[model samples]
Target: MQLVAPLNSSLRRVPPGWVYLAGLIPLAWVIWLTVSGGIGIDPVKEIEHRLGKIALWFLIGGLAITPLRRIAGLNLIRYRRAVGLIAFFYIVLHMLAWIILDMGLLWEQAVRDLIKRSYLYFGMTGAVLLLPLALTSNNASVRRLGRNWRRLHWLVYPAVGFGVLHYLWQMKVITPEGWLWAGVFAGLMALRFRPFRG
Candidate 1:
């Protein structure tokens, strides 16, 4: 607890803007890798997968903030919005990679894929859930919506669930990574119950 105090204090000294700027590094690196032919044979699929996985990572990170603060006495509340918006940005990029590179701007094919693919359906559902949350992430929206804003952002839990399910369903066989994320999601959700609250 003593060591955690200094760490938390140090983290508090860092600006949220710095974190937001740092968050763009992953996207930039992925773009650079794609341009430099460094993303392996199937660059398009790699790009899409990388972006989607990063988005899920950020989503999970954002979800972990509250639990981290409550259980570990670490405070990072200031960066939660930035983390969530970064996740949304990656999600958009992931969809764009699929639509532009994978589907080649073919709406009919994309729509067909959306209809036939359960993973796509789950991913799309997660995207739709995130849309409003992203739109209302600003301070103006918080002021405008008042208490409703909190209720609206609660959608993140379901959005993350769908995102995880999309990832799990996309794999032909469940990997350790899939189980790890599922366990993390389950643990985070469990922590939200009254018994776990401190």
Candidate 2:
């Protein structure tokens, strides 16, 4: 525990590696379980679900940085890009899983799901928005676009909304857990206003 404290300070200054490391452990664990047959039933769906949730959690966590730093006095800004990129990466995986595993690369099925299922459409919309953000995240693109890059990145808020809506719409019963996620996202969105953050 003492060792981790110092590590945490170092991570705060340069957190991309740490963020990847932090996320990799759970991702690797999931892969391991799937390979080892420890996941019991429907391993593919279980893995897909877990990855998607983790991705969404990262997205929310990335969004929470500004509020946490302002309200809670945590310097979470350094990790924001890493968190966002990882969130994008995981969402890509989740999308691929749906496309290849669930839809089996069937264009008709994918189109049908997007058109018919509100949840899928929401998720797909969120994923689509992330593409531009991810592409322009690097130093080169940042320099190339200047202020325009920031404008594009601000789309994250709506993307997050789409993600949360996707989760809520996916759940048949709208459990307390789903409500909690939505509530947190609501709080995050609200915090964007100075009055609320203060």
Candidate 3:
């Protein structure tokens, strides 16, 4: 296709490692804002929200890679692992911000919140789902797992669904942004079905 050529040409010029390095820019900016006291009155909440949002964006980006390659003939497979790892890194930071800054590592209260709050439960479930996928993102695991590797990575779909639900529930009122993310997640999932697999 006419569009594919230009897109592939442009992508070919940029190394996947560069994309990985560039992904750190958001983290750096967040750190700078935190140090400069620019995160407003509630720094913990701000940091947590920002990290969670970034994680979701990266998750969406990683998911998009397959569809992009299939429909647009743009192969960015090389960067999927980096995108996934960056997403996991942000997910960890998001949890840390909640545990250290928000809950002060109060296990009893944290457990109570997890049990009482649906949003917290969704978020925790999403994080737990991501743990195994993150652990096995390396090439060695892929070689060892072989066919099972694909099945293991399929966990990302549900993990992302849980993540979107977590985001929706966490919001006090569903905003347009929340709906947009949900729609995007739904569309991406739909694309994975047989009809769109072609």
Candidate 3: regions farther than 4 A off = 1-3
Of 1 and 2, the candidate ranking higher by lDDT: 1
Q: How many clashes show up per model? A: 0, 0, 0
Q: Go through the candidates in order and give each one's C-alpha lDDT.
A: 0.95, 0.86, 0.92
Best-performing candidate as measured by TM-score: 1
Q: Which regions of candidate 2 are displaced past 4 Å? A: 1-15
lDDT of 1: 0.95
> What ranking of all candidate models by TM-score puts the best one first?
1, 3, 2
Q: Which lDDT tens digits does candidate 1 get at residues 87-177?
A: 9999999999999999999999999988888899899999999999999999999999999999999999999999999999999999998
Best by lDDT: 1
Write one digit per residue (lDDT tens) for candidate 3, span 97-147.
988888899999888877878898888888899999999988899999999
Give residue 164's error in model 1 in angstroms: 0.3
**Candidate 1: Cα lDDT at 92:** 96
- Model 3 CA lDDT for position 198: 88
lDDT of 2 by residue, 93-197 (tens): 888878888888999988987888879888988988889999998999999999999999999999999999998999989999999999999988988987775
